[model samples]
Target: MRKEEKPKIDARLLELLACPLTKGPLVWDEEKSELYSRLAKLAYPVRDGIPVMLPSEARTVDPDAEPARSARSRRE
Candidate 1:
């Protein structure tokens, strides 16, 4: 796959996948190369065309853009 090219996540496979924590539906973030569970506030990484579904492998996502917004404010 191209470096900037978004992974071609199969819709059918995504539909079959769920958050291991919440068992909730996940949103595919093609840009970030992750499957995000908003309910769980967790992002599962996709590496080498594989979904690392392990919760231990998952990481927390920022709930808001505080850091980015603060940096922008300082620049202005």
Candidate 2:
């Protein structure tokens, strides 16, 4: 049996998306299935490839804690 793959948000859509509050860029976190807004200090959940952009639905995040991928990329 073939393993089912998790649905992912389109790259183009991600590029076009921004934080509703700050209108700042968002970073995709595949593992957590969330979009992090650094400027807003929020982590928006992505469900079944659809991003939940509503501020009420978003979870607050620590401003000092960087996403794993972002931290790794910064090392290179």
Candidate 3:
């Protein structure tokens, strides 16, 4: 039997996925391979190319602070 393939996410989809916290959108950092939630100010890591979207998997994000790539990735 052929194994089912997990859905592949791309830059476009990353633009669509949002952070559960603060109801804010997510930004993908291709260089660091992490997902950043602008509103939540938390950074979620991508494992083996898959984004761990769960809140538990997400680290703390200081909404008042700026990420290194915040200005650039805000649109992602």
Candidate 4:
């Protein structure tokens, strides 16, 4: 028998996790389907349903226009 690997965050967990930068509520962008921090103006990609909270793993939003690629990408 094999045990199923569960997601790092479940529905309840999602309710608890907030934006590290803003300390404000985050919304799940169903379109990009990524966890977005509006206050932080960053979008953290959820890989395999696991949100990478690291700032390095995040993409920044251009306050002027639209969301742009993060200037600082995740270092190895």
TM-score against native, each model: 0.76, 0.79, 0.63, 0.64
The candidate, 3 or 4, that scores higher on lDDT is 3
- Residue-level lDDT of model 4, residues 1-76, one tens digit each, is 1335433335566678888887776666544646667678888887776888888899997667443333222211
Return whichever of 1 and 2 wins on lDDT.
2
Model 1 alpha-carbon miss at residue 46, Å? 0.5
Q: lDDT of all predictions, in order shown?
A: 0.71, 0.77, 0.67, 0.64
Best by the TM-score measure:
2
Q: List the residue pairs that clash in candidate 4.
A: none
For model 1, how does the per-residue alpha-carbon lDDT over 1-76 read when each residue is reduced to its tens digit? Answer: 6777666567677778888988887777766678877778888888876889999999898877212221111111
Please give the lDDT score for candidate 4.
Answer: 0.64
Off by over 4 Å in 2: 1-4, 70-76
Supply every candidate's count of residue pairs whose N, Cα or C atoms clash at under 3 angstroms. Answer: 0, 0, 2, 0
Q: Order the candidate numbers by lDDT, best to worst.
A: 2, 1, 3, 4
Evaluated against the true structure, the overall lDDT of model 3 is 0.67
The best candidate in terms of lDDT = 2
Q: Which 10 successive residues of model 2 have the least lDDT summed?
A: 67-76
Error of 3 at 56 (Å): 1.0
Off by over 4 Å in 4: 1-10, 63-76
In candidate 2, clashing pairs total 0
**What is residue 63's positional error in candidate 1, in angstroms?**
1.6
Quality of model 2 by C-alpha lDDT:
0.77
